[model samples]
Target: MHKLWNRIPPLASDYSGVCSILFELNSLNILYTPSGCVHPIVEVDEIRNFDNVFFYKSNLSDIDVIMGVDDKFLAEAELLVLNNPNLEFISIIGTPVSNITNVDFQKIAEELERKTKIPVIIFNTNGFESYNVGIYEGLLMLAKGLSKEAVRNPKHINVIGYSTIALGYKYHLNELVKVLENIGLKVTFFASDGCIKSITEAAKAAVNFVISPEGVGAAEYFKEKFHIPYFMDIPVGLNGISRVLKLLGTHLNVDLSEIEESIVTRTELRGINEYINKNVLIIGEPLTSIGIRECLRADFVINNITIITNLNSTKKSREIYKEDLFSQVIFVEDEEHVAKYISQADIIIADPLYTIFIRKEDNKIFIPLPHIGLSGREFAKMEYEYVGKMGFEYFKKFLKSEV
Candidate 1:
């Protein structure tokens, strides 16, 4: 047996990732697994609010797994497509059972597509990989299957990689859109909010703004196929927002003088400078951790930072911003590893699941930020603002009051 406890729970599984992307589009999403496999995604994640999107779960019984029930799976999919004539697309997501049985989900998807004349996408997510991998694969499949060649519009852009798993993502994206619009840029489509039609129209946009690292695959696909360049940055916090706007301005050759002035004024008005002495520990996906770190360092001068993430540190994430704020960057898989670092921090910013590992005697401040992989949407009802000047203000307020 291992000496240390494996405290770190599995981050959002691959199926969650496929569901996150599919939930945004106008498609009928079906999880090919037993009844229990669908609960975590449906009850805990953000799909609870997506009443318009159709989602179904297949009944894979004991005999089905032992004896192979490909016929049952195909018939169920056929029935759904026949009943819902207006359905744009069908996505079949795999679970642990399907993976173990070596089920040929792709072949079944092809068969379904041929029979119903409806486009079908399959993700063989066996719950072994994390959400980031799932999101990358899901987005790549969407781009490859749906994007078509078209004339480009210099003024339009498609924002990619805004997922439901991000805490307060809707508010963050809305603010980012407002800032872009202020600079006279049109957001043709938000990749996370579009369907097959949106993916087809992506070729018309001049650029793809990859807000998260997960969207990089989709952005690269557009670049090679449509000759569209991408700007990789999630504009969070005051400094984070300013940096993104400046980059956007340079690329588009637009004057963001007014926007810059407004951002500086807003930061000053928020009085974020008062909390410079605070120390923070950030843990999450790579881009999110980086964005929050940049924001905290720039606005509040919280330089005593430590970043713990599931992604590799060498893959351009550490070098994204020239100014380094992280004192230590730890890539972790075990709970004991996370515990060693958490013991030294005064403020902990992470998913709610990490709270269980913290010692009761340790006097530390915790700000609950929900992550789909960690706590899912259990605490999504509690709003945590972490984008734009106003988001920074909310962050400052959170620290001042919570600590």
Candidate 2:
């Protein structure tokens, strides 16, 4: 018998991913699903605060589903376009119904674009895949659809795979931008956050920074199409931050000596040995989990470290944890397995959703590091203030308060 899922909620679906990529853009987002599917994005996702995003729901009823709703989709899309002259673009996102009915949204999107005289992109995201897959696909389509040929600017860079749902995303990006600017580099565009005009000018950037693993595919596209060099790293903690600065300086041949000196002076303000003997568990997507592990291990001489995630293991991911830093590296699917690890660890650093699996009686210190896939927008307000010296200071404060 299939075990019932009463303890843990389902992970965010491909539909959520499609919506996330389009969240900040000044475009019309239409979800072709039953009315119920809309609740997850509207109620659970972070875009609730973004009033600028134009969203619509095509509530396919049982009869409409059986008869098929191609004409209905065309009619509604045309009407929306007619009504909203200010609309920059339109995205048609599919749910499980599209998969079941075998609807070809790509062809429909082409037709709609022709009919409306407006750019229409379709993401037939069946609920079968996880959020990461959806995010990768959506961003890839966006990059291909929007980025145009232009003269490359050697000092400008684009940050790809950036999502509004990430914890402290704005603050962290601002911090990184300051450092980049200090070295005479500019952030030309944030792939997901900027306007369509900015996205179209993406090829102008001299380099691309793939901040999340979700953005790797998009960065690869930029490299091949525009020949823009890309860097794949999410610089967390002081050491990681230093490495990022040095690597970028070396690549661009910039004088980052002043920034390096500032970083050195800041390091003396905090000691790394304070976390000695503390048992810490890092859990989330592979890229994020690895980042946290590097940061925590660098500053604190923790007695035990455990990294847990459900992301597929690749050669690179395996190489990251090949060292003897983690006592155990767990790739778990079910909540029971995750709960087992939570029970053993003294401190749990994971998405808020995992907290549901933890036993109430256990005095485990829960530090919420929100992941879009796990908790949607529940903790969207929380900033991931864990980058550079400020990030190190944040950890020190957190350790003191919790441990």
Best by lDDT: 1
Tens-place lDDT per residue, model 1, 160-198, is 877777444565467778877866677855455555667
lDDT of 2 by residue, 1-403 (tens): 0234466666677678778878778888998876877887788755457565688887568778767878887888888888898888889888888788888788889899989878887777887666666777788888888778989888888878776544334666577778778667877545555578668888888888877766777888988998888877777777667778777777677767677778645444333444556678878766666667777766654547788875434343343335453325676656676777888887888877777767778877787777766677667667556667777676666676233
* Candidate 2, backbone clash total: 3
Model 1, runs deviating above 4 Å: 1-8, 167-169, 266-278, 310-328, 359-361, 399-403
- Looking at model 2, which ten-residue stretch has the lowest summed lDDT? 312-321
Clashing residue pair totals per candidate (backbone < 3 A) = 1, 3
Deviation (Å) of 172 in candidate 1: 3.4
Off by over 4 Å in 2: 1-5, 166-169, 255-257, 269-274, 311-329, 356-364, 401-403
Model 1 C-alpha lDDT versus the unseen true structure:
0.73
